[model samples]
Target: MLSSLAAGFGLGLSLIVAIGAQNLFVLRQGVRREHVLSVVAVCAVSDAVLIALGVSGIGAVVTAVPWLLDVVRWAGAAFLVGYGMLAARRALRPTGAALHVETEAPPAERGGRTMVATTTRTAAVLTCLALTWLNPHVYLDTVFLLGSVAATHGAERGVFGVGAAAASLVWFAALGYGARFLGRWLDSPGAWRVLDGVIALVMWGLAFSLVLPVFTG
Candidate 1:
């Protein structure tokens, strides 16, 4: 049981600690100090739910319906491309105070621009959900791959799932909270532009990778 728990924790962390859209979004929110708790909760809870489903044998059902993944693949690609364009626009023409830390100043004091300071909680939460759910890779990694590995534990599969879920919570908490330290360095609009530019490239690259398999396969 101990071995199974350790294995699950190690594997889960390894799989999740990669550079991806979800992690990027979380990092941005963390740096901005905007809805950090909500974003982290959504991501962690969503991962736990998916891991539960996967450990419960839902992976087999997903495999049986091959078309499900195909549909998700296209949708994910489209969403990523759209988001990439937005990021690119931000990179090319960032607002002067866009990356400034939020303050209690009124809109008039802040040049009568509220949107430049921070996004709505609803928007942030929705974007977080979309980033997590729309990506087919999440399903593949959490539901299929992780599930398969958990299955090898036999009767201890439940423990393994618990360990995996725990890892997700730990990782997201650390990432979302720790990113605020970088906020000082990203104070300048130029820095934001560079960051957004990299985000745009990564988003487009991931989108292309998602659809490339369709063409090749």
Candidate 2:
């Protein structure tokens, strides 16, 4: 049981440790200190739900629907590409003030910057939801792959799922909160540009990967 728990935790951590859209968004929000708690909660909860579904054998049913995966693949690819373009634009023309702000400032003092600085809680939460649910990779990794692996654990699979969910909580909490350390450095517009550039790359790269599988398969 101990071994199975460890294995599940390890597997879950390894899968999520990769640089992906969700991780990047968490880091971005963290740097800006905008809706950090909500974003973290949404991501962790989403992962827990997906992991539960996988362990419940819903993944098999999901994979059986090839057309569904195909549709999600294209939709996800389109969303990523559009978002990547926006990130690339931000990289090209970034304003540090627009990306960062201390909430203590009065709205009038914030001026036009207020509009940019105030990434509404609604927008942030919705974006977080879209990123979590729209990414086909999330489904593949959490549902199909993880679910299939959990099946191998037989009676101990529930324990494995618990361990995996715990890992998700730990990772997101660390990432969403720990990003503040870099906030000072990213105070410079140049640093934000660099970060945005990297985000654009990751988004487009994942988008391409999603599309490639369709053509290749």
Estimate the overall C-alpha local distance difference test score of candidate 1.
0.87
Report RMSD (Å) for each prediction in the order shown: 3.0, 3.1
lDDT of 2 at 101: 43
Candidates in order, TM-scores: namely 0.92, 0.89
- Residue lDDT tens for model 1, 17-63: 99999999999888877788999999999999999999998999999
Which candidate should be chosen as best, given lDDT against the real structure?
1
Q: Which candidate number maximizes TM-score?
A: 1
* Consecutive 10-residue window with the lowest summed lDDT within model 1: 106-115
| Candidate 1 Cα misplacement greater than 4 A, ranges | 96-98, 101-116
- Candidate 1: give its CA RMSD in angstroms: 3.0
